[model samples]
Target: MPQITFLLPDGGTQTLEAGDAPTVMHLAIRHDLPGMPAECGGQLACATCMVDVPEDWRGRVPEASPDERDMIEDRIGSLPEGRRLCCQIAVTPALDGLVVRIPERQG
Candidate 1:
């Protein structure tokens, strides 16, 4: 199993052990972590799963697909270069101990 750590805007953290199958958004929802609504159920059409990949881990996560890229740019609040939709990130053993930051707001 891989471990993921979500750093909430309020300075809280939620860590979970997940297998290499679930998407990051699914992991968040499964653990009942705050800040990721995943309103579109992992579809690229919604950006509710937006989160910022920590600077050091930016290039470690997979690149966003075109559709996800466009949707994120249009709907997420201000973000850094590595911001991405969590739903598009597939959990993997390599992502063990992966860390992501929840933005202050998402719309």
Candidate 2:
């Protein structure tokens, strides 16, 4: 199991044990963390599950797929270096202690 930390929009931090969750989005939705609406669930359709990965942990997470990058660009007009759709990030032991900041609003 990996531990994922969410930096919420309200300036609060939430750390949760990711247990058997398949992805970061699943863990967020499971915990009902603020700022993660995930309206389209884990599908790649909605960009509602966006989160900003800190620079220090960026290398630990996989690079976003081309399609994922396009979707984010389409929604936000431009892709920031750390912005990612949590649904696309698979949970694994390698990602223990991963930290992501939730945007103030979903796309």
Candidate 1 lDDT over 1-107, as tens digits, reads: 89999999799998888854479999888877877788889867779888989879988898888787788767754445888999999998889889999888776
lDDT of 2 by residue, 1-107 (tens): 79999999999999999998999999999999988888888889989999999999999999999989998999999999999999999999999999999999876
Task: State each model's CA lDDT, in order.
Answer: 0.84, 0.94
Worst 10 residues of 2 by lDDT: 34-43
Off by over 4 Å in 2: none
State the TM-score for model 2. Answer: 0.97
Model 1, residue 97: distance off in Å is 1.2
lDDT value, candidate 1, whole model? 0.84
Highest TM-score scorer: 2
Each candidate structure's TM-score, on Cα atoms with residue i matched to residue i, is: 0.91, 0.97
The residue pairs in collision within model 2 are none
Deviation (Å) of 2 in candidate 1: 0.6
